[model samples]
Target: MTPELTRDCQTVADRLRATGHRLVLAESCTCGLLAASIAAVPGVSQHFCGSAVTYREQTKVQWLEVDPDLLSRHSAVSAPVTDQMARAVMRRTDEATVSLAVTGHLGPDAPAELDGRVYLAVCVRSGGPGASRDGRDDPYVVHAHALRLHEQLRVQRQIESAREAWQFLVRVALADI
Candidate 1:
């Protein structure tokens, strides 16, 4: 992770700790980089839950309970998919109060349409319409980011996306959303 990303993750960690909330990560293309960055923060053990490095679609389905039809309709790297992935990971563990999900194609060799595209989702256990006391609808805070695929190496894109994810986390966590 880049130094900026590390600092952002630390900010997120500190903010989460201040609110007494722990985080769970569901990562796809960037793998565990986001989780590792948060773990690097001091006192993170109190605010970090765990992560699922679900690179394969099947793993997302099997472990995170992502709907296969949803993946088929939106592909694995979309905001809708990442939103569902975040909700799944957040609910899967009782320990976390917030969840962050990331999926993207950072590529020199990605599928034609997916290259350089990334989707992110952040879910707070108690803040949304879906997370109501009755456990009804579950809306997530979702976003998408992209860069020119040919403008950077795959590793560089991954690093950039990781940083973006950290920044997103900081925004939501600080707002207590």
Candidate 2:
């Protein structure tokens, strides 16, 4: 991991620990690097749930049970698909209070339309309507964002996207009421 990404994970780990929230990671393009970085944080085992590296569409369907039609329509690296992944992982894990799902195309040989596009989502289970005061719905709300980066080497772009994914999750986890 890059120094910035390591620092980002450390910050995320600290904030999640402070909030007494467990985190689940569903990784697509970044493989498992983001999860590994967070796991490197000391005391992470307390708040860190396991991760699913659903690198392939088949794995995403098999592991997270994402709808094949959804993937076919929006592709795997899309807001709708990633949001589904985040919510699905959160639903599957009793240990996790929130989940982060990431999917993207980092280039090298990606489809023309998907090149350099990354999607990230964060989901929380607060239980009850109007529980969240941060302008989001209660229970199973997936806040998703898409970013387009300069086309770079696949690994290099994946690293950058992973950093953003971690930072975004931390921000949501630390949001004020």
TM-score of each: 0.86, 0.90
The residue-by-residue lDDT of candidate 2 on 72-150, one tens digit each, is 9999989999998998898788778889999998868888888999999998877422243353544676678899978
How would you encode candidate 1's per-residue C-alpha lDDT over 1-177 as one tens digit per residue? 677887788788778767777789999998888878788888898778899999999999999999999999989988878988888998887777788899998877788788788888888776532234555575344444433334468777878888888777767655664
Where does candidate 1 have its weakest 10-residue lDDT segment?
A: 140-149
- Each prediction's Cα lDDT score? 0.79, 0.85
Clashing pairs in 1: 130-137, 130-138
Q: After superposition, how far is residue 20 of candidate 1 from its true place, in Å?
A: 1.8
TM-score of 1: 0.86
Between which residue pairs do clashes occur in model 2? none
